[model samples]
Target: MNQLQNQVSPYLLQHKDNPVHWLPWGNEALDLAIRLDKPIILSIGYAACHWCHVMEHESFENQQVADLMNEHFVCIKVDREERPDIDHIYMDALHQMGVSGGWPLNVFLMPDQKPFYGGTYFPKSNWLQLLNSIQSAFQNHKDELQQSADGFAANLEDKSIGLYPVELNELTPIIPEVLAKISKYLDPIFGGIQKAPKFPLPSLTLFIESFPEKLDTNFDVYIHSERQLEKMAQGGIYDQVGGGFSRYSVDSEWFCPHFEKMLYDNAQLVYVYSKAFQRTSNPLFEEVVNSTIHFLNRELRDSSGLYFASLDADSEGIEGQFYVWEFEELNSIIPYEKHAPFYQAFQIKRNGNWEENKNILFKNHSVLNVVYEKELQTLATVRAKRIRPQTDTKLLLAWNAMLGSGLVQASKGLNNHKFLENAIALEESMIGFWDIKNNLLLHQISYSNQPIYAFLDDYGSYGLFLIHLYNETAKVIYLEKLRKIVNGVYQNHDQMNYLFSFQSNLNAALISNKYEITDSVIPASNSMLCELFFWSGILLNDVTYTLRAKDMLAAVLEQAAANPLYHANWLRVYSEWMENPQALVKYNPSNYAKNELPQLRVTWVPIVDQSHAFLLCIGDRCLSPCESIDELLNQYNSI
Candidate 1:
């Protein structure tokens, strides 16, 4: 009687055998809770989330705990990825309750699905205590909780409705100032935007693409940003031993990382570094880019071609156990002659780098100055033997799309065919497995043969990826696929004005649902959809997509134009359209001469269909696509 057997989310299926009569988040679960007059215990998590798995194994699977849950409460399970709207609402409630929200989020809701209390995780004893207390409150103080639920629901509905205004045209002009504020938020010493426990800031990185023109020649802001990036690249947050980056740094100095390796972070960072390489021609940026891609190829990618989601932050139930090492271990690995200088330079004391006896990682910035010295190579060789952390092998569509775009960027900037080849391979993998039919992409693919339907973000992101890759490779297959997916998204989600809604057909089954619009780590799907439409129109030489793109852009134009600084996504679209509002088609990537000319601002639409592999040069007067890569190079050289 495992209710989750019919569910698609792997996270939900992990609790299938629990004695608790777990219901998937739907109208049925809400209706049951209302009918039974019981509090709803809603648990939210994703499959790749380690803590989510840990909580599942510890409590959700325990028969006694399950029995308690089944008898006293109506338990429900939700996958955060499958339905971000539900997760967002509950997470907001948790935040409002003054708790920092995280995966394995457990919320106590009234029969009406209004969350009254939520905490990330609790041990068995604490969980039991809370459950007992909650049951008591629900039974004895029922009217108070009911009143609170009513209030909560009204406030939540109002919040969701207020998030997306009907007219946003007034806000676009101020985008520059908000973007500057974002830049100001960057830690000059450390790499990330904020303080400790920093996220990779992929959203910010994408936003950086629009700022080069605004920056000065010395690019002080740009230099500061690059310096922060370099600090991070050299720091332990980036796997110095491995090629990929971890989830984020625990401390602001980028000294200690959480140790989880995410495919999305690396992919996005790679794209950022590649652009940095092109912008500055910095050798350090190039090295980081190469090393990152090396890590992606070596560990994260599956044989079938799609990239995995993330590596766990902890292994064998001990956080940082796999990645950390003792000083003796490093000493044993290093030769006698090289040990002293290496140890001193890295701040490696006899005790250790992190928790006294255990080594985290340390990099001497001075090493860059002396990297050519003979001692450096010998030290690097010895340091490679430590045990690395395990990787999460779940392939995610959104992540793969990010990687695809990264490869295209790397290829464009580095002129590396290998990068292009890897991009193609990964894209092929996504198309092969996630394409479902000729129309849609799936969200996740696991080894257990379970195929989950993609969410709004996945489809939007994947579509963006296809378009970017087509721009790079100009492969017909990619463009055609891009066309299909874009049209598919419009078919699947568009109600009227082309403002993309996150809720899909599957979400209609939910008893009480709400629409929301706050771009989380990634930009909103509708924002991405608009960008895709603009680029698609320019690349395909189609006016219909262009008109749609105009409407989409106009929809947000006023807000974006008025306050474009805060709206990074809108600024990015503006950057693309800046050259010629009407003559966007004149900036096609397939034009060889036009494509090769560096120093000109570059914006590419994904060209999927196999068009001529030449570069199109957009000058003051004419248009002709160069026939060959060398020809394009020759034109740039002449210029």
Candidate 2:
């Protein structure tokens, strides 16, 4: 057994019995590399990555390749989900070396842990050649390799300030430009980033929701946003039989998805779909929301209600084996009377709609245009009997928070109070991750029951989600969590202007501390913090937090205008700010009708002071207190 045999990360455990001498990323591995004076093989990936599995089988599991690796390098295996900060740093180093980044990220670093060279997955022969070459280069060309490592190391800070922003552009002017810039990239017909291997980027939908300034008759932003959601819901990327979404579609038209299901992707998608349902009253979006929630609850969630990280892309050693179906299987599953239309709606070809005689269930038409829930459910039952994909059971703080906040939105949008209860309960369960005795919140709770130090996202994202919950429930518990998280973030704030480093006080500096500015699959920690502080300010009636939020947003806004896709979350907060949203507060908790308040229209910040009426205010700008919930809604609607 290798060092990974004792690790809690499922990704690490998967490779535990491999022939390669795999060491989980830590000081032990680093110290070993230095002692042996060997270049470190830093292989970073997660459990759900299909390519990672392929590489493991082809190279790490092969005795010959493992022998060469053991002879030449100290191989450190890092589960990216467990140490995203480490992944972020090394990936940035790879990018700096003029390499496009993906996982299984195999980077060769000097004994000092400076990355000199790297690439994605390599076949056994190529992996052997690379290992032998890197070793030879290390012995013969030590100075040059160290030089390359130094150059890459110097450039790995993420220049996050410049990349993300310090927001200088006025909200009014940039709002139109941000919309126009993002609109140019929209696949008008397909809906999402205009590219193949398309991800369900929540930023695009959330940005549209934030600022819906239509370009022209040729392009309506709202319709384009809805089309993307509808197309995704109707496509294979979404599990037609099951209720969750896969990581991404491998095609331009949302068909044939890369099958891993991520907690973050599904969580963000729920929030976006729920918001769309509120805006358009689209039942299809509502259906997607409810089903995805059901899927997460059933599959991704633990018995404790905390969601696991992701479901692997493969089952029984074949990609999409668990999700895809043979054409005949579909034919036999559908009712005899409904066979023809079900086949037509799902694009089920006799041979296959996709690879190797297997069909990924899909519809060419919009979800709203078709009704096939009955047929899909039948397929789901049959699919359940197949060997399931291995689940990565790492519970991440930000991810749970993302889903919890989405549920809060869905409950308000769909008026499902049961969803609300679950959201609250999920957060309540997360209390275990918080160390009340030490006042240290953790990013993950391991199998050994040790608490890992919180990252900025763990602090910021969960804090932001808690703030959202407080808005919905007016509960003190969420706010109390927010207080701990806010202090943790501030403790780690250091001196990086308005931005916070990705590492918390407990997280040691890697080669460098990553400051997330650009929003990717999830909002950057700084961006979420901007929103967190803004809402926290309103909720606590603290002016300092409001200023901190404004400062951070202003800085990010400067860099966001040029590339809105990268900084969509920043712009979303800025747009929400422009709306001058009032905190519809009531002095009496009994006066606040949970369902009566229009959630999307008004940002609720509950304060049960001694006042008699509902007070609505945008910072200092205040509307007269209203006597009834009806009166408050009337005043809110007028705005």
Candidate 3:
């Protein structure tokens, strides 16, 4: 019987009726592997992964392949979104085997749960051969395989902290040097790195925006960052008719995306674009922000104010089916008069701008003013009639918190209090998922049931969001909530070498207490923890928090300097640390004007002090309170 029938994860459910008897990852499956004396086929993938669906259709659903798999292995299906801990463990194991990591990651693990061999996405023919070969190896050379697994298991101990040794960071001006190194990879003509299959890693642009007041010896990082943002805003990766961005482009030109829309990516991109708008007053940035927010509201949001995980990359058994458009489809929808400009602007080709004789809408950055606003709405109205991509209904706390954080930041950029209000509403909803006394957080908000515990990223991200809220609202309650989360991370998580832990659960997995030191598509949980500690330390007036936060950044500074793209989040924190971020204790709610200052140095610590004065503080030290906002601004500018 397929044990996955009971699972809430869409990915697991996708395989529930498969000919292979797939069990959700649990002790039952592991014990079955041991009892049957069989190797474990641990398949990990997320709901929205196009290849995951492909593999399911090609192999798992094939009765012949299923017979081979069922006879040899106790197959365990894990939705990476539902069980990131298990995913991280096996994915790391795959990496330790010197394989580049991706989904759907298929690993052959021992009954003891240590991964011996792994590879991603195999054809049915290869998979069949692999199953027989692996089964033969297990029967004949069990001892040798165990030893190899042991070696890989030992190397898994080198998770983040052990792999990247904690150095005695100089706390000197490393930003200039790091920026110089990063400048080498920046695709100046287009926005992102000079590599194909580009991701809109907001961290890179965000880091460029984090230049201190004094780091102006050379390099206009803003221009390069702006160019990238503008390119993305005008690219196919960003949905032109609809709102929100796809996962990433499959090309350097941002012409074709992988087309999975993750809540985290959209959330992070919104925050990045808002900052861009704040700095440059670019209407495109504002429009993108507004449109993306609308996308989130209309599609992703549950009436409860939390969001769903992602939109699947595949629709109707075809990737990009929902998002891409045919040439004639555009011709029929657009008016005859506007067809020329619309086709010219969107670069729609009769043979398709993308695969399958369809166009992925995008405009050349030079011709962004070629108007098609009314035509886009018409297209959206028509496109709305097609079958939509499946939404992964799992409402992750980390993702929701990120969107909340983005909304707060957006409120600043758009000069609209509505964003902040929306953020507050989201908090009201998400706060229900937390068990503050036990330091317990549900992995995702669910209308029915939430069986998973929140991971380290969830805690760190929620804490970071609370920090943003506290600053924006001057609500001491947000800081108090942040303190609880910080305490939870400190007490609940087992430390990895000298750095922070990767997840909230201590006993969930078999091996590796990893530290997420570098940034990926989303900022690492530890980087968020660093921010959490930095602010909680500053605002809460705790020296322990400050020192711990500083140590976290210290551990990654050298590595972060070496490769800033993967460590851009850490670089942002390091840059802020070097600047000695000052907190301004304002007696009123922080408006957009105060927060959006160019090269702003002070962090807002809002309080309803009876005397409407501004208190400037650095670490624990504070200057005399200023009499007025003007005086504070003047004083801050001079300093």
Candidate 4:
């Protein structure tokens, strides 16, 4: 074992026994690079990435390749989940280098940590050739390489420097046009954008569902939402036996998945499907929501109620080994009487849909008619005997917060008290990490019980979770906690207009301060913060939070205008900003069931307060106080 044996990150630990001397990204590695005047081979990936595993086996574990890497460069490995701040910096560098970014990110940087060349996975021979070439270039042409690195670093810094200030007036008129452009990519049949690899772009779907008024008359957002939800639920990307969704589908049909389950993805998905269930009263959506929550509670949850980061795709060193099954194996496991229905329901074929006669179970027929719970249980029981995939046990604050918030939303939509109970438990557990004196949260609790400083996403999502809890329970303490977190986040920023992805003190080793604007697999932290600001402003009647939200939206208006889908979360914030008559309803706790408010079905009604009477407000204007639920509903409808 090397230096990585001392690290807490699961991804780093996976490489602890590798021949390559892998150092975790920190001052030691950086200092070594500087002292030796050696270029750095920085590799970034997560535990769940299949290609990352493949690359590790192909080149990193190979003795010849390890010797070359050790002799020529200072090699650093980063777990993207644990250190997304580092990933963002280098991924942005790769994009700036005009390369499309993906997992197993291999970038060769100068001793100063400026990336001059990079690419994704390469075969062993190619990797060896590239290493030799890079070493040669560093030795023979130092000046040219330094000039290129300097130019790249300068360009990267430039992206963060200038901003064209946008006013609220300029943002309103562009909404309709932005929505129209976004709709052009929507797949009428399969529901996501017409693309080969389909992701359940939750923010995009949420934005589409949130603002139906902005969509063209020809486009029905519900149809798109329903189709997408149904397809994903029936797809192999979803664990039909187990609950929760895989990362993304490799094919447009959603039948082939990458097979890693992430906390953030499932959390966002739970929110998405729950909203769909509420809007359409679809049983399928309700089932997906329930099963997903079950999966989280069963598979991902720690004893303290915090969710783990992810479940790896590969088990026993083979991709999809744990998930797929052979036709003969299934027949032998399941009884003869139940075999036909089971095979037919899951689209299990003798020929197999995946590699080496192994099938990835998907609903080829109508999902509505199928009820294979017994069969699924049988399969699950049998599969449990096999070696399970490695679970990345680190508890991430932002991801757990997302899941907690999602549980609250799901509970409301499904009217399931158990979900709400789980949410409350999760919230309680997450609160333990809060440093009340410092007014900040720890980013994650490692398996070894080490605490890392919180990043922007941790503050944004956790703060939002607190706000959600406040709305649900009408507890003033959560609101107070949110206020402190908000204050702490703003204290680090030079300007309150936009928040950076990493906190100021936490980002000492980063090449540049990054403001994450575009939504990737999860919603952007800046966008989540904008949502937090808008809601908190109205709930607390604070103008500063509201005004700052508008300014932050304005700051990203140009980017939102350019690629609205990439900035889908920003559009959700913009939609909330533009669409007014946001009903802030206050009611007496004695008059109604505080926990079970059917009125929450209305997404616009964000704030709920317990008082002697019910009052509805739209921005400063207030309706006359009502005494009962009926009167409150009538007043809300009239506006």
Model 4: per-residue Cα lDDT over 1-639, one tens digit each? 257998888899999999998998878889999999999999999999999999999999999999999999999998888888888888888998899899999999999999899999989999999999999999999899999998888776535521776777644566677777887998887778899788888998887776654353545556777788888888899999888899999999889899999999999999888877877798888888988888988899888878888999999998888999998888888854666876787788888988899999898654652377777888889888889999998889899998988998898789888888898888889866766666556777653334457888888899899888777777778878888778768765434335554544544546766777788678888888888888878778698988878788878878787899888888777766654434466655555556545444343233345454677776446679777677778877786
Best by TM-score: 2
- Tens digits of per-residue lDDT for model 3, 336-453: 4656867887788889978778888888864443266778888788888889999998878889999999999999888999999999999999866775666577777542233566
CA shift of 115, model 1, Å: 2.7
What's the TM-score of every candidate structure?
A: 0.82, 0.95, 0.94, 0.94
Error of 1 at 3 (Å): 6.1
Backbone clashes in model 3, listed as residue pairs = none
Q: Give the TM-score of candidate 3.
A: 0.94
lDDT over C-alpha atoms for residue 359 of model 4: 95
**Could you tally the backbone clashes for each prediction?**
48, 8, 0, 0
1-639: candidate 2 lDDT, tens digit per residue: 367777899999999999889987777889999999999999999999999999999999999988888888999999899988889999888888788989999999999989999999999889889888999999999999999899888888655474454434334556666777887898988889899889888976887864444333424668778889999999999988888899998898889899999999999999999988887898889988999999999998898779999999999999999988787776677754566887887788889988798888888876542376677677777878999999999999889999999999999788888988989999888976876788678789774334568888887779878877887787887777787778788875553767888876575557887788889888888998888887777677688988888878766677777788988888888776644333445445666566555554455667765376577766447788888778877876787
lDDT of each structure? Answer: 0.67, 0.82, 0.81, 0.81
Best prediction by lDDT: 2
Model 4 — which ten-residue stretch has the worst lDDT? 599-608
Model 4 Cα RMSD, Å? 2.5
